[model samples]
Target: MNFSQIAQLLVLGMAPLGAGSYALCRAKARPERFGGAKFHSPSWYYGWYGFLWAFLPPLLLAVASWILRLAGLRPAPDWVLMALAMGLGLAGLVYAHRSVNPELRARNSVEGVIHWTLRMSSVLSILITVGIVSSVLFEALQFFSQVSLWEFLTGTSWSPGTAFLGAAGRETEGVAKPLFGSVPLFAGTFLITAISLLVAVPIGLFAAIFLSEYASLPMRRIFKPALEILAGIPSVVYGFFAAITVSPWVVNTAQALGVRADYTNALSPGLVMGVMIIPFVSSLSDDVLNAVPMSMREGSYALGATTSETIRRVLLPAALPGIVAAVLLAFSRAVGETMIVVMAAGLRPNLTWNPLEGVTTVTVRIVDALVGDQAFDSLETLSAFGLGLVLLVFTLILNVISAYIIRRFRQKYE
Candidate 1:
């Protein structure tokens, strides 16, 4: 038998063994309950207690086998392993069923196990996050060992595909030395993000204000969901919309005004991304603005202030923390956006301020590198992890800045 067969047989054995143990424990516990004896816990707890004991030993053995394999231990014969697993499981079942008495605090024991299991699960999540970070850091460190950090940061050239090309995949003849400069990539990312923000912020904020304050209840109900529907649309759909429809329109509009524009310009994706981000700012800002104390609005009205004046002087200031948070969230979404930029924005990686020109982003390059035919250990492949590390740092810095802003805003406003 192979691994899958052994696993299947072990599972099949454990299932019936657990069920039989549960049945036996319940039958034994019931007679004591009907015989006028006080039970410390419910009858089901005894059943679960028996089931766990029967299954847990076998699971531990499997885990131990896996650990041993990882440590280069030879595998035992499949029949021997299967027999050992089944024999231990059956032994556990018999021992646990016999131990289930009225005085056994089976419920407490089960609950304690459940509590530990939940705690372990939470810890596992943290460990998984750590593992991901560690893997990226490790690979990025390897890349930096080959390519300088200063060159990656300051140099403008980013011709990794051509530079890192070779059969042996080393710094051999005909393979140009790699340029890891990330300035163009970061510039394009931020430039698109800046355009997206300019378009999204004012519109989303104003929409939020109108919905939460000015619009009638029925109108608010109708308009709010309609606005949020944009958020529900997939990024691919937005990408296609930008590429096919928006790009040509932008090009034509620029030409009509006697200005030059590329077909795969930055503005198109930026606009579509802005549209994508509208609901993030609008929905959250609306909720935050509404959460501002009603008394504040009443006070502004009592002061003979108009709606606009009240919002400027009272409501907005009070809701600044949440509003800032919403904008930060939108900015992050725009920064991380890939599909829209890949489809709409050109992959030229130009470090320019002009929105009509093409540009590429970190995520675009990361996808390109991973999907290429490069060897797994090659410089081209490892560059993805290096880019990932940079992306991770950028996102972490954004989050930290957002946290500081929120904390300062809360302290001042509260």
Candidate 2:
């Protein structure tokens, strides 16, 4: 059979083997005299052992088959090899289970292997993260090689089109700076984030306070998960709402204030993003606020401090570090957001301070540049990497600083 077919058979083979292994392991652990030693684990542990034996060997063999293909040693379809490997592994496990004594220490040895397998699974996730970071770094390095570090960093103009033309062509007209500067993008990110925070923080914090400090247990049970429902709403829905409904309302509201406003401006998206993040901020803030020593709040209240005073002065200060961390986390989420900005914010990269005007963000540009099929070597494509790297560095710095602040605050409290 073809490779894919074999692969499918292998996957199908694994299911029965895994179930059979578990059954065999449980049977082996039954109180029956067989081979010499006594089983050290419970029936379930043996079952887990059987599953590990059935799954791990075939997985390893499939990996080996892939490597062989990469090395031009394709002998049989990968699926066939995988199925064969799994069948063999299952046979070995069954033989071992039937022959081994229920009271034997073999179960312990199998359990050990199962534990190692579980730990190894985590490497898949870590390796994927490392792969992404490595790719971004490599592409960013390539971009820097073509564009001088100073021009890319310090130059107010960010027109990457000049980088597309070779030195021969650039000698006549010089590099035409991209009309879209990153500052506006950065500013737009901050403006939207700031507005979102303004909208979310107070509402989220108050909700958190009500839930944690004032709400009845029944009310908390009902409200907490309801608040989390906000987070569960798909971001794309938020984008559509901002783009279709919120933008027009914002424009009309600005007109009422005797100011012109673009329909697709930063305000609408920022407001929607704020609504999205409120649950995040509230949930985290609530946890932090609740973590404050009850005695502290009681002491303030006993001293005749009102609820608001105690919340503002005692609970808030106590929770400041965690709240700051939460805010920074929310800010990072906002900054990295793409859909809301892409759908609601206009694509025109104007270096304007006015949130009422049409402006673009770094994330929007990154999407625009990389969305369609294009040659990877082109400047337009490479510019996405450059912008991504800058964004990565910015977020990393903020995270580091926020972590430092949180740690220092913890130390003070301790």
Candidate 3:
């Protein structure tokens, strides 16, 4: 294989080997550690320790090397660098393992590294969000400086054609509004999201209920995974399905009903997006629902409540906060969805409510504005950042509210 392929394989191999070595070390450190024996540390802790030693150094080296390359510095050959890094990393692991006491210093040190790793993962997510927000803010600030914020927001016209074509010094015939009037985009997003939730929520909830409350062990094993298969299909495939098959059918059906429908309207994409989000809503909701104490269920049943009634009144209420969190998370997913909307929803930004007619969403516009080659500072290009900022804010607010509610719910239960 080529260098890239070889690098990939080496990295992949390192992860499992590191994991296995850590597991071995943990097993060795634990005393009779079986049922009735004292152990040096928990088995899982040792596994994580091994994972740290095996994965962290090489990963860091690779990342640092890539950054250096980006900064225009040529590094040593990949094979030589990889070999030296791995050798040094392994030597460090060995030294730490032997020098640190398994019961005292090593355990805490390993645990500290693992904890730091976990915290780093969370920080990585937050940093990514901040980076996205910063990019949007910077670009939107540029766009706003060029075009008045009032005209951008309130003017009833939107044709980004001038921004793309660089039609400079033309006489002003009328106010040239941005093609980014969020009303139609937001409306389209909500309509599509509503449709998706409508499609996904009931089916997912029922599926979860069946899995958690009614299914036999064998059936649970079979169906839970089968349902999850929906989540695994690449979104591009869903987009294609919606574009080629579903859009035509929707147009035809709308025509039969005496409604004017674009071949690529909101309904097909919304419906497909709903299908895509089903597993997310259902899986999370089911897990939250299942987390409700069995004692609560039994107490309700003892009071003469039937299974369904108990589920509705007791279990559902108990799990309501988590369920809401799940739904909100799904809503965020729907809002941020790009491919399905891009492929299935018409690009025309019509400020109409007729779901049968064509409509566009913020994500659709962002894609349209940013995809082709154009002046980077143009309103059309920068409008993407503005749209992204709005979307980011909306989703961030939802996430915050969901997190607060869930945290409060947990405190109440505790």
Candidate 4:
């Protein structure tokens, strides 16, 4: 149904709820009614109970109708469904109003509804994740059927420009076969991620240490929020900054030093992406360091240890798991980043060790494959899913390692 129709249905459902709440409130105040028994719940709970009774039926109806439509079935007209929903809501409201008695435990009923709502929300989230993985896996399987997994993983070249012609059965006999080697993409991705971590980890860790251990209260308050503002800035904005500002500076500085650098060098985007993710590391590491016990610091002082020594030996070790987790999380963020890499790092899948050279990441290649007018079943188009699946696996492995580190070594300080 349209927004207006949905709003009208919700209004019809909720009007009785407000009425029921106030009515029960007034009724409960009159103790002589129902032989002076105390209410099983507060009036607000009764109101919510009535609200759910009125709302759920119509919501279910709409969902069922929508599902049926998706399955290619003819459903009732919107107005007819809206009318049916209104009738169900009114009937529910009447039932709720009549059922309101001192013996009815509306609080329990309302809480049960809330519990189920939360459970359903969790289920929906899990289902969505499973659906996404399954769909990508299926498509990636199709891609691998055409291109061998060995070549895709170990090949050094990634020229897929003419793969479409092969898929369309029009490949010229003299043409070289399209190579799907993903090694360069993976290398570029890791190269950028390593550069970003190099810039982010030291700066972010030091900032966190200063905030958690050294900075004054006022300084910490001002700086922490200011630092976190970096996280709030959009990736596209960082991409723009990298492209317009950092890339040119890198090229010019390289030329001044008699070293050549591409305008789309990996360093520019890496630096920008590092700056963008500094808050992720800093914020998380700060919280973790702060969580280290005051008792540990006191013990260190009692042992005649200096502040720096205490932090290095005691707090850092204690919070190492959290710090590692934060670093890994940042690694995942850096690996998955697209906009900055796309804008600053050129789309050439170069297998090179030099950060000054332009290179493409998996995410950039995925975007390239899916963006233009290409056949849906083409090897080039399906390669996006293959890249996505590999990326997904990489992320999952990182998460598993992070979990293991946290679970195995995390210290519980009182």
lDDT tens per residue, model 2, 293-345:
88888899999999999998888878989888788867877877788887888
TM-score of 3: 0.78
Write one digit per residue (lDDT tens) for candidate 4, span 90-114: 7777777777788888889889988
Which candidate's TM-score is highest? Answer: 4
Comparing 1 and 2 by lDDT, which wins? 1
lDDT of each: 0.87, 0.77, 0.76, 0.87
Name the weakest run of 10 consecutive residues (lDDT summed) in model 2. 163-172
lDDT of 1 by residue, 23-52 (tens): 887777775445767778888888888888
Write down the lDDT that model 4 would get. 0.87
By lDDT: ranked, best first? 4, 1, 2, 3
> What digit string (tens of lDDT, one per residue) describes model 3 on residues 136-221?
89888888777776765664455777675443444545756445455667777788888888888888888888888999999988
Q: What TM-score does each of the candidates earn?
A: 0.79, 0.86, 0.78, 0.93
Candidate 4 similarity to native, TM-score: 0.93
- Candidate 4 runs further than 4 Å off: 2-8, 11-32, 169-171
Ranking by TM-score: 4, 2, 1, 3
Error of 1 at 249 (Å): 0.8
Q: What is the lDDT, from 0 to 100, of the residue 129 in candidate 1?
A: 94
